[model samples]
Target: MAELESPKMMPKSITFLSSLLQRVADSNDLHREFQPQKISVFHGLTRPTISIQSYLERIFKYANCSPSCFVVAYVYLDRFAQRQPSLPINSLNVHRLLITSVLVSAKFMDDMYYNNAYYARVGGISTIEMNYLEVDFLFGLGFNLNVTPNTFHTYCSYLQREMMQQPSLNLAESSLNLGRSLKVHLCFNEDETSHQQQQLAV
Candidate 1:
């Protein structure tokens, strides 16, 4: 559909987008050195709120996933779909987008693709097709698929650690805390720094 022209010129979404991001950084207890381009925005007309991924998230939500992964995939696909030669083509399959997005995210974040069966072995789904989906997945993310929730998690962990002097707890809390700390390492950029530096930063 055509965007209806309003009575007068309206402020660009970027203006408000910048303010929203500033608020986010403030909420996360981070410095304001970040800019809007340093972040990404989710786009529209995605799979309805009542979708398969939504149901799965309700049942079993991973801290690094469930919500974050699905939201990221939705945004990436929307960005690409809008850039297409056509407006609202609706050519991409939502299920395929979700599957491949999660798969790509797995590779980017944790180096885990435990769903190899779903990608390459399930019901005669060939390995070649899985490879195709991988490339397509990258394409959907505008060929800049470096994002992973782990990155966000890493930042959050560092802040929490800095805020506390000595957070004391028992065995279970230790385990949970360790798991949570590991989640923070998700933001470390392998390409930008030595894996050792990632350890030092987080």
Candidate 2:
């Protein structure tokens, strides 16, 4: 199995949400160079109208999951990318990739999570597609879902540092505001989220 990983990186104080957003934005920035055929072969679509930020916001609003799940999802995406370079993140496949990663992360990290059908509805994909994505993602990941405490802490600390270095921006403000409204907590302070996760892990 591939080793567990974290987001390619951000400063120490970077909120997991912001780091994840930056990661997707970086992928989208490089989307132009990706071959269309590669995306279509996996996602069955060649273009995504919805932005990664907006789609992640939707998941946060509806999934009502812990913020840690997003960090784990980012890790899963990194693993997926490392394991399957041919299916790199691009405009066409990123949405589906995000959805699948988050779903898998939630299942692996959270005890109470929506099932595949529910995730499909949330992701705007068919149940069949969601199931297929889940299977494919698991295979691609070599089913390495166990993230150690040290690795998890490493990711959290990295994200926190990144948050510290980044300047406040409208996107961060709006995203945090929306996250607050949705009651989907994005922990700028890692302590609370890490505590909860540790409790759950026990």
Model 1 segments beyond 4 Å from truth? 1-67, 85-92, 120-125, 148-202
- TM-score of model 2 vs. true structure: 0.67
Q: lDDT of candidate 2 vs native?
A: 0.64
lDDT of 2 by residue, 1-202 (tens): 1222433332223234644555444544454454332443346445667766667776776675677887788777766765675665655677787888889999988989988988888888889999999899899889988766655776766566546665443333443465421111233334565576779889
| Local accuracy of candidate 1 as per-residue lDDT tens digits, 23-114 | 22232222222312211112123423444333223212222233344334434443444343221212113334445555665555553445
Whole-model Cα lDDT per candidate? 0.38, 0.64
Off by over 4 Å in 2: 1-37, 40-44, 167-202
